[model samples]
Target: MKNITCLLASILLAIVVQAQELKLKPRKADALGGTAFAHSISDSTLSLVAREEIIFREIKNGNVPSFLRKFQKIVSKATIDNKDYELVFFVLPDYLAIGHNDDYFYMPMTPILAQKVANLLHCSLPTRKITDLIDQNATLKLTPQPIPPSKAMTTVPVFITHNDLVKQQMQPYLSQHANGALTVGNKKDIVISNKIYGETTPRVVIYGWHQLDGKPIQPLYNKHTNTWADYSHGVRLVQNTMWLNGKKTTLAKILADPLLSQLLSDEGIIEKSYYPVFDNY
Candidate 1:
């Protein structure tokens, strides 16, 4: 009696374990994002209960070779809306079977997915070289070599100005980002430097130009001069401007320049501050 009771318990445990194995089924049209009905199967018995439209004969007959079968549960083909589609299943292993819902089996990964599943199954997956993997009709193109770094810069120049105070304030900022050497000289003196310039044209930043007492200069028509005087020059203390690439430009314009944009980005400037203005240009 004791031996018989032990045998019965073992059988019951086996039945419980088998029942725990995952079974995936088709999701209805409403849930499939209007694509098509889908289903998954790991056993031949699935054919008996699966819908008639889900073609299962290929999987049930073991048409797919063992090597391919080790990765994914066999693939079954179906026709919906006159379009052909493939259905694949996920099989839970015997050791730790778990229940899964329909969505879990909807879309499986491509080539690499099979390899991952094979690894989980503790099976040896065959490897194919790139030459073997490429189809006869497919062509592989090599990437073109990049332009030499030496030719990245196009022009170089030395800045000579009378505003020593403003120059002193901007020197550190310019020196840090200058791909070429930063040369400063008096209005009458010439400073020469042997520094390689990058592809971008460099600029000089001038402050408090076309205005008296270093005040913020606005673009206004001077009636006496009868010309657009202050409009071309001046940087305000609160509303500052800079000479970008040798042109007197506003901060908005400086951020728009592509090379300056990259430079500002490299200097740890946040993108959101300038991205909106840059997008328009």
Candidate 2:
């Protein structure tokens, strides 16, 4: 009985020693942004040092494309509950953007880049379990309605072509218009490009023509720092004002005319004397 008691005491001492040794180490913070840390899970500890070092090495080795590197920015870093985390933002060439919070990483890339990152990290991507829960709990009803007769509709195609061609087309109207007036297509393209380049003060992305559910939507990228605004409404309101009795006008004519600019300024879409500010950081 004394031998049995000794053996149990030894086992307990060993367990206590192991528990004391299991500790998390603070990792080096990235200069651009991101704090490195060791995460303890069950019997194993995962180090971000290995993952981060690999990324930097690959980048230095020129493994990542130059275009992708241009949009990569370390937005911020923070320490929470004795653990450090970094928020890195990336705007891909394909217009797929990603950002992260402490609890979750949000990526519009969905299956493509998200899967690739998951593979690199040797982790599985998280599914929308909350969405599943909502669907399971909620009652959905489907009702059939009478189908209306389809009417023949004539659609006018809008073209965004060469700059020279656009300038040439607008020459007739240019003499009457202001110097800085831009066509509808030009305005839309510039704003979308600005979002991708992180030029916007509170980054905003304009959906491609009829991209989201056949309707255009402008969504803010930096939701944490920026308030959600309906930019789509402002864009549509300006476009409607430019239209003459719902008839589409030529790009050159629109650019050459001061009426569009006046209307846009009046509607608060564009400032009276607007200047584009480029963000260097």
Candidate 3:
């Protein structure tokens, strides 16, 4: 009896360790600004749908005539049993665009991708469970509706600072906008990009998401400091913002910044701008 108790404890410990070690880094955002992430039932989880394709220029002209048929077979095999992974094809004309009956990552149904996925899953046996879950629970588990900007009175300011690596990453997007303005109601926001000023110069961007709208809206990210005013019901409110290095706290601090709270209460931007002074180490 004691040996059995010890064995049970060991099994419990193993499960605890496995749960602690589970981690996933979301895939970088796709062209549409959507990042791919996932949750799983076990360590042995397999991707349900994956998009695999060869570019035309990557293949010989004559190869397309023969390779096209092979591509069809690959898709057919991939879709069987509602393969769980999703594949997005950029190819035009005959590109298999979406999934058919598969439990794909993004919940919304894209007919092209969906039909292709259905075709592929029609042949696989192992993926049937995912397909069945998708059929039964899809309505509940599919993509969540976005929250409207007006209702999101609680604005979270995420200030990314002191990271040369991250600034280098955002340069491309900033160059495109170059102070281009995006307006939400009476408020107009600008996009700023830079290559220099690693210290204290934090870039900022705002994302307005709507729960009922899944449209991709541009989100601003920056390293240097910037400011904006909040006006509601014909009143102007002001706020000074800064970065707090605590890993997951940026989102909350921005919304509740003292300056923002005061501005909203006062009904206007501050007559005197307050710089969030940070001490250097």
Model 1 off-target regions past 4 Å? 23-29, 33-111, 115-281
- For 92-113, candidate 1 gives per-residue lDDT tens digits of 1110111112111111111122
RMSD of each: 34.2, 28.5, 25.9
Candidate 2's error at 2, in angstroms? Answer: 99
> Quick one: best TM-score, which candidate?
2
Candidate 3: regions farther than 4 A off: 1-32, 35-126, 133-281
Query: Which of candidates 1 and 3 reaches a greater lDDT?
Result: 1
Q: Per-model C-alpha lDDT, please?
A: 0.22, 0.23, 0.21
Q: Put down candidate 2 lDDT per residue, 1-281, tens digits, no spaces.
A: 97898687657544532332101122223311111111111112322233334333332333321222221111223444555533222112111111111211101211222223333322222111211121222122111111122221100001111222333444564432222121222111112112223344433323322221222222223232122222111121011111222232322232233544221112221221111222211
How do the residues 62-111 of candidate 3 rate in per-residue lDDT, one tens digit apiece?
11111111111011112224433221111111111111111111122111
Lowest-scoring 10 consecutive residues by lDDT in candidate 2? 152-161
The per-prediction tally of clashing pairs is 3, 1, 49
